[model samples]
Target: MSKVRVAVIGCGSISKHRHIPEYADNSNVELVAFVDPVIERAEEYAAKHGGKAYADYETMLAEVKPDAVSVCTPNYLHAPMSIAAANAGAHVLVEKPMAVTDEEAAAMNEAAAKNGVKLMVGHNQRLMPPHVKAKQILDSGVLGKVLTFRTSFGHPGPDGWSIDGAGSWFFRKNEAIMGAMGDLGVHKSDLIRYLLSDEVSEVAAFIATIDKPGDVDDNANVIVRMKSGAIGSLVASWTYYKGEDNSTVLWCEKGVMKIGTHPEDQVIVELRDGSVEKHKVGEISTNTKQLSSGIVDAFIDSIINDTVPAISGEEGRKSLKVILSAFESQATGQFIKVN
Candidate 1:
C-alpha cells in the first residue's frame, strides 16, 4: 500500500494531541475517519485533518474500512474497540494500560492475530530519545549490572489534559480502571523492562487515594523484583502539584545512570572511577510541553512494512501485568508474582 489509510477511534486529549496530529504529519498515512461519542469533537478533527467524523466506531469501521485504527478511547473500551477494528481487518495502535484485565488484553491480541493485523500499543516511553539512548548504554555493558533503581512519573493530574476537565473519565473507576498507576506507573514499568531487558518477576505495593477526589488511587509506591534479581521502586502519583517529574535513576555495579533527573542533561552516567558522561539526546515528551511521541510513526511504519511493532500487544500486556500485580500486591499485602 502506498499510504496506510488510518482512523482514530476517540477524539480525546490523547487522540487530539498525539495520534491525529502525528498521523496527519506522516506522509505514509491517510487520515480516513475520526470517531467519538461527542460528535462535535470528531467533527472538529475531521474539519482540520480531512476525514469523515462518525459518532460510533463500529459505523466508522464499516464505512471507512480503514487500513489501520488508533484506539484512543477510555481504558475500558480499548480491548473491545481494538478487537472490533482488527476483526474488520484494520491494524490497531492502542493507548497504554491496553486493557482493564489480563483476559481482555489477551483477547485483543488474539483478535489481531486471528485477523492477520498488526497490534501496537502506545507505550511511548520506550520510544523516547533519552530512553533509547539509555537502553543502548545499558546494552553496551558500560553500567555493568543494574543493581537497584527508582523510577517515578508524577504530575498534578489529568484534569488539565483531559477533554472533560475535572469530570473526566480519568477520575471514574469504571472508565479508568486505575488512576496514577494505570496512567503513569505502567509507562515506567514498560520503560524499566525495555531498558533492563528483563521482566518484573514480583511486585509489592501500597496504593491509596491520597489527594485526588476520585475512587481510584492517586498515589502508588511499588517495589519490583526483576527476573534477573534486580530490585527497585516504582512510584506513580497524581499529586505532584508543583511540577511534573518523570525521572529514573539506576544504581549499577560500575556506575549510576540517571535519566531525566537533570534539567540540562537527559542521561547522566557517573562511573565508579569518578568520570561523568552527560547526554542530551533529545527532549522527553512532558504533559505541559507535548512533543511527537514517535508512537504514531512506529505504528504506521509497521503497517507499511508489514513488520511487528516495537511495542507489540504482548509487550504491552507484560507491562500492564506488572501494574496489575502491583494492585494485587497492595490488596493482599504480599509480594505478588507477575504472570
Candidate 2:
C-alpha cells in the first residue's frame, strides 16, 4: 500500500493532540476516519482532519477498511477495540497498559495473530532519544553489570490533561482500574525493560489512593527484582505538586546514569573514575503542545517498511505484568513473582 489508510478509535485529548496530528504529518498515511462514542467530538476531529466521524468503531472498520488503526480509548476498552480493529484487517497501535488483565491482553494478541496483522503498544518512552541512548550505553556493558536503580513518573493529575478534565474516565476505577500505576507506572515498567533489556522477576508494592478524587490509586511505591539479579524501586504518583517528575537513576557497578531528570540534560552519565558525560538530547514533552512522542512516526514507518514495531504486543504484555504483579504484591503484602 503506498498510502496506509488510517483510523483512530478515540477522539480524546491524546488523539486530538498527538495521534491525529502526527498521522496528518506523516506522508505515508491518509487519515480516513475518527471514532468516538461522543459523536460531537468525533465530528469535530473529522471535520478538521477530513475523515468520516464514527460513533461505532466496528462500522468504521467495516466501511473504511483502514490499513492501520490507533486504539486510544479508555483503559478497559483498549483490548476489545484493538482486537476488533485487528480482526477487521488493520494493524493496531494500542495505547499502553495494553489491557486491565493478562487474559484480555492475551486475547488481543491472539486476535492479531489470527488476523495476520501487526499489533504494537504505545510505550512511547522507549522511543525517546535519551532512553534509546541509555539502552545503547547499557548494552555496551561499559558500566559493568547494573546493580540497582530508582525510576519514577508523576504529575499533578490527569485533570490537567484528560479530554474530560476532572471528570475524565481516568478517575473511575472501572474504567482506569489502577490510576497512577496503570497510567504512569506501566510507562516506566516498559522503559526499564527497554533500558536494561531485562524482565522483572518479582515485585513488592505499597499502592494507595492518597489525595486523589476517585477510587483508583494515586500513588504507588513498588520494589522489583529483575531477572538479571538487579533490584530497583518504581514509583508512580499523581500527588507530585511540585511538577512532573519522569526520571530514572540507574546505578551500575562502575557508574550511574540519569534519564529525563533535568530540562537541560536528557541523559547524565557519571563513572566512579570522576568522569562525567552529559547528553543534551532535547526536551521531553510536558503538555499537549509539545506532544511529539515519535510514536506516530515510528508506527507509520513500521507499516511502510513492513518491519515489526519496536514495542510489540508481547513486549507490552511483559510491561503490564510488572504493574499487575505490583498490585498483587500490595494486596498480599509480599513479593509477587512475575510469570
Each prediction's whole-model lDDT (CA): 0.94, 0.90
Model 2, residue 326: distance off in Å is: 0.7
**Candidate 1 has which clashing residue pairs, if any?**
none
Model 2 alpha-carbon miss at residue 173, Å: 1.0
List, residue by residue over 1-339, the lDDT tens digit for candidate 1: 478999999999999889999999999988989999999998998998898999999999989999999999889999999999999999999999999899999999999999999999999999999999999999999889999999999999999889899999999999999999999999999999999999999999999999889799999999999999999999999999997999999999999999999887999999999999999999889978899999999998888788999999999999999999999998999889996
lDDT value, candidate 1, whole model: 0.94
Candidate 1, TM-score vs. the true structure?
0.99
The C-alpha local distance difference test score for the whole of candidate 2 amounts to 0.90
lDDT per residue, candidate 2, 94-171, as tens digits?
Answer: 998899999999999999899989899999889878888888888888899999999999999889889899999999
- Counting clashing residue pairs in each candidate, in order, gives 0, 0
Q: What is the C-alpha RMSD of each candidate to the true structure, in Å?
A: 0.7, 1.1
TM-score of 2: 0.98
Query: Which one is best on TM-score?
Result: 1
